[model samples]
Target chain A: MAANQEEVKLLGVVGSPFVCRVRIALKFKGIEYEFLEENLANKSDLLLKYNPVHKKVPVFVHNEKPIAESLVIVEYIDETWNNNPILPSDPYQKALARFWSKFIDDKVVGAAWKSAFTVDEKERGKNVQEALEGLQFLEDEIKEKKFFGGEEIGLVDIAGVFIAFWIPIVQEIAGLQLFSSEKFPNLYKWSQELINHSVVKEVLPPREPLFAFFKGRYESLIASQ
Target chain B: MAANQEEVKLLGVVGSPFVCRVRIALKFKGIEYEFLEENLANKSDLLLKYNPVHKKVPVFVHNEKPIAESLVIVEYIDETWNNNPILPSDPYQKALARFWSKFIDDKVVGAAWKSAFTVDEKERGKNVQEALEGLQFLEDEIKEKKFFGGEEIGLVDIAGVFIAFWIPIVQEIAGLQLFSSEKFPNLYKWSQELINHSVVKEVLPPREPLFAFFKGRYESLIASQ
Candidate 1:
């Protein structure tokens, strides 16, 4: 535990995969932090002040020094606390971890989310195809490992909090079958193992409530478009 | 230098700021390595094999292992050869560097590039405004510091290679005077310092040819759209 753990505070809303990532990292490092839930519709002054550029959350403040962006915060936690090393010690492996984590964000999540929520049929089809292509790359990368971390929950696994928990539910709600156990057995199994992991399990948004929240939000989001 | 200096290979185009970032890092570290100038229109087979995911350049290969993404490769170089420490040693300060570097990519460069290239009058105006707003943040961050690294050319400075050298010519060729020294004196001065810095100056593409290249590319991109 950090000697200044008492000074740590995380400003975020519940059910955001971005927030969940920071939560998981904090838990993994055993750092005690105040969780200030922000209403996204009406963001607090703290949110605006800490993250003036993005003005969004997973803002990790330690001793009043705020660090926004989930991956940056996660790396900071690992470097600061050195308890359970989140990233690999080797430089090459570390770069691979960073690469895969970024690929998840850029390719997997971006395409998958658009596949789910886009109201236009042609766009959604394009998204679904791109999402599947991205997932195929992930599937090949995973091969037989239970996690991208391979026997430990490292940065890539933590960065993949969305794929493990959120995307499946979103896919189900949006009625877009972009991911399936049949299509991607290894990734499917990896997701199950990741969500079931002790550290990740503790921080997961309760599925029932998250599902209900997204159902309402997704419907309204589709309607607005 | 690494014991395997013979094995370090960087595959990228000359004018890309992303490629320039890796070059700056390598030159800063005083690493002697092979530089493969890639034809972006017809990417090499090695490039294809190395970066199948993005199929893009600025792929840093060390000892047969390739790492894609400019920021990721930069971090890898820093960790691999600790000769010149690119990131701040303090955790909080390191996080700030990462945040600002990312902000440069996500906000500053993206908006500035679009501002220059977008053919639509209204879209270009919006991009111009957003680009200036992004530059304003950088202006305040820079203030009176000689560099983001405070007298040292660090990751943020390396990351903003485009701003220092590429974007000015691009903005000029596109006939969009979005960035001006009068409006952003600090940033403009910082950019001047950065471009003239010994490490940065070595790999920068000649301004005349780069202007001609962008002039052609930008004109064609607009016509195609």
Candidate 2:
């Protein structure tokens, strides 16, 4: 397929940490692509057909071939574009990047966020403690580094975009104070840098609306209890 | 660091499916490494130090730098030793391999296996049904291909190693019959090929002992109910 003729498209939902990873990657690599907003309530046929397994966004379609999972899509973009590499050149360093990215996605974000959202107060407190410990681990990892991938904003930073933007909003809505500057100074500093970065700033959803959206969900969760 | 002088080591347990992944990948690459068996009951300081976050095996250490997570370690091995390439050279193809590999690790192995281990009979049946559906999805994906990554036993094959060896033993011990040749012929064929492969065969725990080991665990799980 010809380079110019090949169409690139991203199917994603706004305010999703996963979707933001791909969008930031695309912009950083200076790739031009169409962005299709997916209504997750009633998912689009394209989204379902493209990603039959997870059926989640952001799904990156290049030359009509679909690739799901945010980290996978980001890696694909890095490989295809070549310029402004998100992953390190050395194999070992790249492996380290992938390891931390998976950590942030699976443990820090997946487990911690789920815990913060739990309705039961006692269970929520225990999970929140565990989640804070996870964040502390990350804080130690990112100590004195400009970004998770070092000097430049790379794959690990993109993977942790949730910590920069989404989590604070979630904390507010859930009335939970899990990640605070006092406890996790390094991570708090990193989050500020991440949100302030030019590329990240472009894709981040406005804070007030995001807060309002999650507030409703949090209230519903607590009301059921 | 001199290539010959560099030390390669794997921290693993005999019957762990995750450990098998790194072992097979190392064997495929013809890399010689010392294997350290971990007693999960009292985890060694070495395993704990290497994988502080998860503290789970297998941890792949090269030149004393530890890399945890099976898929990450496999990718690191593939990149470091380029002789027998597991991941496809093409970026797009590589992405597809990663997507499916993550699916097998996260969905097929993680969720389905947990369901198979459920103590409640009714819940186990529901989970087993869901697991079968997941396997059918894989069976369809594999279609007529000799392996997941085509002719070669690539990353996807390594990731799905659990389905080939561990699941059968788990089914037997749990007194469940989730995967069968009649239901998932392709995966069944793939499993046979996987276990019989010279490199894989070397690392596989003897079936009888594996069965006994899991039977004890399954009995305990049921007894707790």
lDDT of 1 by residue, A108-154 (tens): 88888888888899998998998899889988999999788889899
Against the true structure, whose lDDT is highest?
A: 1
TM-scores for candidates 1 onward, in order = 0.97, 0.96
Model 1: CA > 4 A from native: A1-5, B1-5, B222-225
- Superposing all C-alpha atoms, what RMSD in Å does each candidate have to the true structure? 1.5, 1.8
The regions of model 2 sitting more than 4 angstroms off are A1-5, B1-5
Here, model 2's chain A TM-score works out at: 0.95
Residue-level lDDT tens digits of model 2 in A57-134:
999999899999999999999998888899999988999999999988777786567765887778877778777877
Clashes of 1: 0
lDDT of 2 at B161: 89
Task: Give the whole-model CA lDDT for all candidates, comma-separated.
Answer: 0.90, 0.88
Candidate 1 chain B lDDT trough over 10 residues, lowest sum: B1-10
Q: Distance from true position, residue A93, model 2, in Å?
A: 1.0
Listed in order, the DockQ scores are: 0.94, 0.90
Q: Hey, what RMSD does candidate 1 come out at?
A: 1.5
